[model samples]
Target: MADPTLKAALRGGEFIVAPGIFDMISARMADRMGFAALYATGYGTVASHLGVPDAGIATFTDMVSRMSRFAQGTRTPVIADADTGYGGLLNVRHTVQGYEAGGVTAIQIEDQEVPKKCGHTPGRRVIPAEEMALKIEVAAEARRSDDFLIIARTDARTTLGLDEAIRRGKLYARAGADIIFIESPESEEEMRRIGGEIDAPLLANNVEGGRTPILPAETLKAIGYNVAIFPAIGFLSVARALEGAYAHLRRNGDSHGLETYAFSDMNELMGFPEVWEFDAKWARPERSQAAE
Candidate 1:
């Protein structure tokens, strides 16, 4: 099961749709909802943890700690976004090792420079193709297992153009990367063209309310994408819900009008029933032992 996550995604043209999860609850929820995997989204992590946008503020230690928690919370494979490898070639190697140890099945390292912003956001810059290829080579070599994937992401489309993104993606793939991710294509035609041009297994990043048009998983699969990560859906929706809830609480001094689960219902959702059963089983055995 080392690299079975991506291998299964590549089988039978089944485009794997991994939902972006920032915390353990979201990761477990996505697992219960039966997603193929969980994307440990850097954007979501920064937004959720620091209440800041994904502008490279989070550190490598921060990411590793959170990723470890996410991995511990669920049985699903996690594909982590290792932004710019946290530094140069040596950093890329270290990042891969850390992520692999944290139970990451794949690590996606982008071509954008350190202090990288989100792909959909403006003012993004990428390193030279050869330089990024060297980074990919280092990432591929640093992995502990053959199944652990080295996903090479190029954010050149927003800065240079679609052609340059493809060029860089091909180079990264040739450098022994397992997947080519061309971030934030401007149009559906460009998306199709990327699928056509990049011969490697490809990853499509579908950011919510971002530059790239959100396409269906079936459409992405038909267009030759092996994976699609919706990195902001959970964060955006939860933010909206919390905003409304806070407004209601401030205005009404209570959550009376809001439709929310009862305390017991929420406890069940959080697996309290399982916890209670375990306690009962152990307590009963202890009582029996005491009597004996």
Candidate 2:
């Protein structure tokens, strides 16, 4: 029954819309908006929660905890960024176990070298193809469900180059990756070229303001990629919204500018009524006593 939402989506030829959701509120909103699944964004989480760059500072424990909340909030399948599997091939077994035990549907391990950085980071490097592929094998071997996907992401496009990226992606796929990603390809040509080339279920990273072009969802579906992860879209919206709200308060000593987006509307976005209900219920012992 675990990850049934994700498993069903992966079965059909249609590309899965797995939005990058950082916190529980965003994840629950994504589920309500009819997203088939959730993709945990390492960048978004670090930026939103820690007020830090995604310089590999976010801990695996923090991510797993956030994922647990997301899964509970929506019961939607969550595929998380278990970045570099939090270390090496040896680290992957435990990392996968932690994610599975936390109720995430899948974990994505990347080929970036140890003490890894994000795919868009300039100095990012990948481990040797052979070494990274072994990590993929370990991840799959450790997983309890065939339905629990192991996505092998190769940042080799920016590091070792595209030929090597494709090469490593295939090797990882061969090594037991249920899905494979060639991250941050710069152009539509490369997207089409790579999409045409890979036989395994391919995934795309559609980060806004990244090197990759922002193609429409329908375009990617026609191009045959199985999953498209827009890891920054939700976070970007949140950032812009917060900035707009703060500016209004500072400029006028009021929130008149924020009137365009009401607090009630923002609360609705988070399903805040449910939280209010819980608080209201708990504040009344009479409700609990009456039920008893």
Candidate 3:
């Protein structure tokens, strides 16, 4: 469906795994791996693709291009990150319209100002609650898919404190956000508090090794959060392994010294042969090469 976020919100309280992806292949891999949802991770996309932080460095066009890739690659819906909606109210409105055009089912817009830092980073600042409320209104107004969801994200708890965050969350809820994500609640008590107070459906970003508390899926379910996205969980592990392999190769003269997942298994897992076959068929390979 064009607007997947609506269906997801209507499902309301189901348990679904949202794996993050940086590009088309990774999004396809997540769908193949049995994930029902995909998270278009700005942090991961910026870092993996641009080798930098998610500090509002990426343009609206940049973010939506990746969203298009993720949406096109999977049957599952994508919940994309429209980091601070790229600018003020007008900019946010434009951002939502662009994402809808890209076929994003859902997207999260934070309250951080322009040139904002990642939610995980310190020294973050939010526009006044009233200003962000207007931005949320613009987002809702711009959404063509009624089922396409608009998630309002607040970085206030860490920046301004939990009380202010809760107040802002209510303001966003009042403004028309289908879902509210109060990023990085440090304690379960705060989590419970937000869950108890926020009237709308809730989504959580539970990145492994992040500053936020890592609650189990069941625990989050009980706490009243509807969706939990584990962004960078796989990336962190992959980075560690890749770094270890490089060090091993430099020190031991080959990567064979490190015990690792077998190459055949990894290729099978990545659908290497299938991809090669798919590539070869349409590639119009040279007759001699094909015969050989």
Best by lDDT: 1
Report every candidate's CA lDDT: 0.86, 0.82, 0.82
Residue-level lDDT of model 1, residues 1-292, one tens digit each, is 2447666666556678899998766886787887777899998898778888888898888888887778766788888888999998898889888988888888889998878998888899988999999998998889888878889999999879888999998999999998889998989999999999889999988888899898988888888888999989888888888899999999999988797547886677678999999988877556768799
Q: What is the number of backbone collisions in each predicted candidate, taken in the order shown? A: 0, 0, 1
Mark the regions of model 3 whose C-alpha exceeds 4 Å error after superposition. 1-12, 257-292
lDDT of 1 at 157: 92
TM-score (all chains, Cα) for each model: 0.92, 0.90, 0.88
* lDDT tens readout by residue for model 3, 1-292: 4655446545755765688887665676677776667888888888877888888888987787878777876778888999999887788888888887887888899998778887877888888999888888889988887887889999888878999999999999899898899987888899999889887788888877667787888988887888888878657766898899888998989766598878887687667999989998879868998899
Candidate 2: tens digits of C-alpha lDDT, residues 72-93: 6676788888889888767789
Worst 10 residues of 1 by lDDT: 1-10
Q: After superposition, how far is residue 117 of candidate 2 from its true place, in Å?
A: 1.5
Off by over 4 Å in 2: 265-292
Candidate that scores best on TM-score: 1
Question: What's model 3's TM-score?
Answer: 0.88
